[model samples]
Target: MEAVVERFLKYIKCDTKSDEETGVTPSTPGQMEFAKKLAEELKNIGMSNVSLDENGYVMAEVPSNTDKNVPVIGFIAHMDTAPDMSGKNVNPKIVENYDGNDIVLNKDQNIVLKVKDFPEIKECVGKTIITTDGTTLLGADDKAGVAEIITAVDYLIKNPSIEHGTVKIAFTPDEEIGCGADHFDVEKFNADFAYTIDGGSVGELECENFNAAGAVVSIKGRNVHPGSAKDKMINSMLIANEFIFMLPDTETPSHTEGYEGFYHITSLKGDVEETKIHYIIRDFDKQKFEERKYIMSAIVQSLNKKYGEDTVSVEIKDQYYNMKEKIQPVKHIVDTAFRAMEECEVVPKVVPIRGGTDGARLSYMGLPTPNLFTGGYNFHGRYEFIPTFAMEKAVDVILKIIELYTKA
Candidate 1:
């Protein structure tokens, strides 16, 4: 739909970038503003039971046209853009009939999205592409997914002749901070199985994701005089550095890819007296994931043994686990997504997610959820771009999944 592109452009202009430091659910007030607009748009498209929560979760339903006992399916996407890039005043440029050449994102900044850097741009061929202007993220990471889902639901509502089961849709906030499903009322939404349309590229259907956790390593030191008392003064910052070095440097996010796990140092700050190192650990394998956390705590324990017992404290909190454990029991849900892609002539790229999704947490919350593609590329960055043709295909994939479910 031409309206989908227009809607995406309007949505990105809302400046819905999430704040990691904020304790609030949506994190930014702009997210709430965008959520409200999306809810209104969902209602306008004639979705049933359209509602928004106080915490900024929007859910709507498209009732089944068929009289069969088919399972109610849900589609989900996050509302907030990544905080790593600016979402403020995102000026989207439409590249019609993508010529497969390097297009300048900003002539003033000398920013060019090169074909050499991203050869995948060649895949779009003659398709329309929406990209940022080098100043802000395009917000297509999940907004494109969101727009695709809503557009599909709208299509289903308009064409009542297309026999399908009940469809549920949800728009969530704070997914960038990894708490998208923290306040999600899954039971209230009431779908047997759901799919989060948050994948990076087209043909993506990821049921397995990283088993994740966050670690806060606090290093305490005795700061006497650095010049006069050498033995009495302990540099906490140096100890923090030492602690970071204990983990395998090769396992960092920058170094690792695919299913390989990493101990990513997210933030580091300290002085001579006190220092803190924040880390996020990720692994796809359950046993390996546990071992990674255990190894981290052991490193801290060893440091504490050398120093005082409480000198180095490691506080590790489990964020979310791989959805493979939860989705394995309901394997057919994954198959449904797979067949949906194939039926739409989109090859199924069933890969393990290197990162976590709201679906990962929702699966553990008693819903077997997987992820689908929205045709976004170079997400959460200024170079972020999306193929409009791929997004239009996403709409087909969603409806196809619903059709496959009912037929099965």
Candidate 2:
């Protein structure tokens, strides 16, 4: 069997960084290249109906070996890494039998993964852990997920004696920028239910995620000579800063957790001529989510009233909503995951996702897709790492879910 760790190490080297500015599906050429490679891999692994679509969505089917009819299940993961960090030229370091000490990721650069900052590293004791060299993200956000699903399917195909039902697998692109399901052909995929193997840590099963939206504030200001700019000049950069400050300071991502919603400022860039601030609004409550958008719009209006009419323009677009509503109607799907986790001896962590996932959007698209873990931590950053054992365990969980589904 191909090791999940080996697959992850190889997949992360592809430099599949998604670009939000791009209009095309997959967003970047690297994603398309990666998808093609993965599609070929699926075919080589004996998966049927293996296809890499124009949008870089790779879908494959694992034919059922059982005689009785069983519901088709799908497992999904994203191919693109977050735009927040560079996924290029990644150099991974392995720590064997981690002793729970501070790991120095780059000795020359003196970059260390401090235990104090990330105490969770202690949990991976006596296991092989993979980490970045402090120069780039590990891309474990969903690559680990990709590896786990593939490894599990490979195991199923190799062990045809282990009775199982039809299983579908999908690898999506541009999930980080919130367009993963925008072009998803759920009807064609033909799954009764699905799970996105894209969560953090082991044994995480998430059905609830944030109700999300994006707010873009465009600030236009007049640049004048500092010598006589007192009343004549309007500093749009300052106005942008004020617009951000107008939002409640305590309601930001850093200040909230565990069912608490947040207003995350993703980017702020500008000069006096023009400034654009990008923010993502999230909430678990539908009403609160709407209120948050209202607050953002009200702030933009107040800034416009202060600066001048049309000086500050704001655009708020609704992203994915909480999947709880969709998943609740099919709660047994979550139950099956919990049972599968127990069978795998993985203590299930049923938590609400603070951020959204491709599964959340897919759930609303008529697929009650929950989320599973990749056994990774500190995702989308330099400190990102994953335990080899945890990743192997994820493969086991996937297999267990397939087995449990056949019994059902």
Candidate 3:
């Protein structure tokens, strides 16, 4: 458990923030650097077939010691943290024996993690908690997952007497930007089923995620001098603003939760000459997801009609779909994780993921992968933290899941 904490702290220190604007695999050079370091660590731990691919995915195998044939199961976690916040110089503050009080993260900046705002802190009372400095995000979102998987495999290597089947481990990059599965070679992974250690909170087991799409709204307007402009100048920024106001305000990320769909305007930039607006649409139901995209198209059509022809152009790309459609056919895979959690004394909390994971795309790629918890909370921001005990429990659950498979 201490080893898990040490491994997590060590991994988070590396700056591996993914960039969506990079337009390249791994998205950033830091991801490739981290991937190489992880590959070396895997080889040193005696894991066989250790390889880091060109796209910064690290894959390794823990060979079976038992004579009995057991199903191969893989554990996956992303290497890169979300690009929403800074990942550089993450100074983790460990709260030894949390007292269920507000934790002052940065005294100089007056930044704090108040229990009143995040009441979940009360649940972690008496447990060791890891938080970040006010300046940067704690990369526990999936770094904790990475450490837990490595620590579990390390434990198996040391305790070879514990009979188990072959276990596959993978660390992916650019998951934050939804490209983790884009270049993943599922055929090469050679696992019957896998689990992504990328969920939030303890005891979380998610098989369903929102069907997602990215919308890029491009607006082009003719620029004219104000003195000579009379219906000759069109403000593209104002048109973009009008387009945003057309979407339902009540159906946004802040207003919705638990299967409720939303249209999230991620970014808007430009001026009268040209403006571009970026949005992401999410819905659990496939039909509703399609309708949301259709609504966006209809709005663009109306805008273009009003502003003349070809003024508003939209490019909507489908990012990923609900994994429930893929996982439901193989129900036992989820059951195995549930049983593993219970056996490890962690209560199972089966919930729908409000966001997608690399596992969702993997499931569609013929590997029915579901998501498991990394014990992280308030991910992708400065207030992000994780319970040390929850991380330890996650490692235990991974080992128990492997043990259960061997018995089966």
Candidate 4:
């Protein structure tokens, strides 16, 4: 357990924050450094075939101890942290024997993890925890996942009596930018099934995620002098507003939950001559996901008719889809995870994710992957933290899952 926390602390300080604007495979050089370090750690733990590729994906194999034709399983976690905040110079604080009260993260900045806001913090009473200062994110989003998987592998190696099948592990890059699975080699990964240790909190086992797509509305307008702007001036920003108004006001991230779909406006920037509105259309249902994309195009067409031809242009790109379609065929993969959690004394909370995961894409890519919890909370922000006992439980869960599969 101490080793797990020590490894996690070492990882978060590496500053592997990914950049979406880089137009490169990793989008940041720091990710490569982290991948190299993880590969070395995997090799050090007696993992075979430990290799880090040029695309910044690190892969390794743990051989099966028994020869009963067990299925090849995989565990995946991302190496890059979110670009939403600074991952550099992360100074993590360890709090032992939490007293179930507000935690002062930064005394000078008045950054506190208040009990009034997050009731979950109180759940870790008497347990040790790790948190960041008010300055930067803790990078536990997937780093914790990475640590848990590796720690479990190390345990299996140390205790050879716990028989298991072939285990494949991968650490990916650029998951925060939505391209984690873009260049993934399904054939090379070679797993009958997989689990991404990327879910938030303990017992969060997710197999369903939103079928998603991106819609970019480009508005072309004519700027004219104020004196003669009565008929000629077409403010693209006004057109963009009309497009936003056309959508269902209540159907958004802020207002929706539990299988509810949403049209999120990610970015909006413009002037008199041109305006661009970036939106993400999401739904768990395939038909509704398509309908939402059509609605965005319809709104653009209506405005184009009101303005002129080519005045409103939309570029719709399919990002990723619901993994439910892929995983439903292999339901027992998720069931095995639930049973594994129960074996670890962790109650399984099977919930549908409102957003997507790299597992969602990997499942569609023939991995049949689902998501497992990392025991971290408030990832990708300054308030991020993880419980020490929760991580120990996660490592136990992984070991138990392999045990169940091998024993069967």
Candidate 5:
């Protein structure tokens, strides 16, 4: 447990925030630096076949200790933090024995983790927790997962008497930007199945995620001088607003929950001459997902019809899909994780991921990967936090999963 905490604290300091506009494998240099550090640490922990590829993927193996033919299980996590917030100079603060009250992250900045907003923090009463100092994200989104996996593998190596089959481990980069699996070598990893330790909260066990697509809407407008602008000026910013209003107002992230999906406008930038609007469409059902994309296109077509031909254009790209489609045949993998959590005295919450994970894409790549919990909450923001006990419980669950697989 101490090792897990130490490793998590150490890893967050590397500032590996991913970038989407870089058009590079890692999208950022810090990811490669973190990968190199992890590869070296894997070798130091006596892991075999340690390799850090050019694309910033780190892989290693834990050799089998028993003659029994057990399925090779892989545990994976990402190396980079979300680009939505600052990961640099992440000053984390530890709260010893929380009292279920609001946590003052930065008194100078008036940043408080209010219990009324995030009631989940009450669960950490009488337990130690870690949080950011209100200026940056804590990087616990997947770093906690990374620490748990490495710590579990390290424990297995130290206690060779605990017989187990081959275990594969990997740490990927740019998961935040949706390219975590772009260069992944599933065949090279050579595992029968894998689990991504990247879910939120302590007991979460997920196999379903939103079918996703990204759409970019470009609006071209004619800007004329205000004094001479009768019907000659077409304001692109106003047209962008019209495009936004065309979608269902309630069908948004803030207004939906559970399996219900929504259209999210990630960014908007432009002026009267031209405006570019970036949107992400998500739905659990494939048909509904397609409908969402079609709706966006329909809106663009209608706008172009009213504003003349070629006035509005849209480009849409399909992202990852629901892993439930891939994991249904291998349902036992999720069941094993459930039993492992129960055996570790942790209640299992089989919930659907509101957002996608590296597992979502990996499952489509013939790996049938599911997601496990990392005890994190309020990710990609300043209010993000994780309890120390929950992280230790996650490591225990990981070890128990391996133990159950070996005995099976």
Candidate 6:
């Protein structure tokens, strides 16, 4: 049992699932608990200036060991899991020396990880893999990242001869709910650039992510008696369906892929008198992103013209934008990580993030952070799993990135 794996297993048990409805910093108590634990671990690992803020952000630093002037680098990972699934009592099952076949996560529940469904698992044929027991999510989304960063720092602390510059690390809460960077004290962390270890799969290096915005469409209708409901009564749900149909059916999360943006209707709730439809609009291109938002507004306007004014109201808010605009100015930060991956014998797979990470917002906040992989796949769900060897490789990559900076 490697230290990273041990840490990951221990951390997931704390159940730090985030909720947006709470309207609080951590959004849940478990996140604060997890933050305290991580803060204690940082102190025990010999990190300096360790601090856990009220908002559940844990920050610490590894003091520079060499005489050469090196830029302060930051590594970050979120603490909370997504609200999509249960993170409580996460029972992880390890498949030792995987034989490249279907893995039965839970026999009673008949839950299986089939190769046909996820052909990517075939890549882990001869390696050890960690998966959930089909009931709760395995918190590898960013927990694997948290473990990798801590392990890398621990290694650096033990091996004092491997001189490196100041390294800052932070574990944020509510990244799953888009509030990871809300209270980040960037000036205090004080890093020239950062890399978020929150990406999926091995060798993934992402500098671009979707320009994201969230839209809420609320509908009001007039309800009448059943006998008088012919023309007098208006069904808001029917109008909601019309709005849904207005958007291009082909342009959705299921239908779109690789650099193609989509309009995802996350939730729809309403009856006759009132209804609310929640949407998340995403696009990698700036123009397309604005167009997507415009499309939603246009539909609302069109619906209002037919159903009557004030019947359909939509509120769209910008969440985060593409980090490429900021990262392009400091391209060498990406190049350094790319070169480090190659040196570690890991194939570099540079791709645009279909989804956003804390790095996306941090870039605009003057951190110019890019994303690095945690070697985990199928994030935010029960089928989430990560290869142990890949985790080890990620640790190697992190150390290599630090070493590369020292050499510069």
Please report the candidate that would top TM-score against the real structure. 5
Put down candidate 5 lDDT per residue, 229-252, tens digits, no spaces. Answer: 999999999999999999999999
Ranking by lDDT: 5, 3, 6, 2, 1, 4
Kindly list the per-residue Cα lDDT of model 4 for residues 1-408, writing each as its tens digit: 677888888888898899877899888999998888998889888999998889999999999888798999999999888888999999999999999989999999899999898899988999998999879999888899999999989988898887789999999999987889988888998999999999888999999999988888999888999789998899888888888899999999999999999999988999989999988889999999989988888887888788899999999998888898899999988999999999888999999987777998998888899999999998889989999888888888888888888878
Give the local distance difference test score of model 5: 0.96
lDDT of 5 at 234: 95
Superpose all Cα atoms of candidate 2 onto the true structure and report the RMSD in Å to 1 decimal: 0.9
Q: Rate the local accuracy (lDDT) of all candidates.
A: 0.90, 0.93, 0.95, 0.90, 0.96, 0.94
Q: What is the lDDT of residue 67 in candidate 6?
A: 94
Number of clashes recorded per candidate: 0, 0, 0, 0, 0, 0
Candidate 5 clashing pairs, residues 3+ apart or interchain? none
TM-score of 2: 0.99
The TM-score, computed over Cα atoms with residue i paired to residue i, of candidate 4 is: 0.95
**Over the stretch 1-408, how does candidate 6's per-residue lDDT look in tens digits?**
299998988988999999988999999999999999999999998999999999999999999999999999999999999999999999999999999999999999999999999899999989999999999999998899999999999999988999999999999999998899999999999999999999999999999999999899999998899787997999999999999999999999999999999999989999999999999999999999999999899989999999899999999999999999999999999999999999999999999999999999999999999999999999988899999988888999999999998998
Q: Deviation in angstroms for 395 in model 2?
A: 0.6
- Pull out the clashing pairs in model 6: none
- Candidate 5, residue 399: the lDDT equals 97
- TM-score-wise, the better of 4 and 6 is 6
Of 5 and 6, which scores higher on lDDT? 5
Residues 343-400 of candidate 3 have per-residue lDDT tens digits of 9999999999999899999999999999999999999998999999999999999999
With candidate 4 superimposed using the best TM-score fit, by how many Å does residue 104's alpha carbon deviate from the native? 2.7
Please name the candidate that would achieve the greatest lDDT relative to the true structure.
Answer: 5
What is the TM-score of each predicted model, taking all chains together?
A: 0.95, 0.99, 0.99, 0.95, 0.99, 0.99
Candidate 4: give its CA RMSD in angstroms.
1.6
Global CA lDDT of candidate 6, please?
Answer: 0.94
By summed lDDT, the worst window of 10 consecutive residues in model 5 runs over 292-301
Clashes of 3: 0
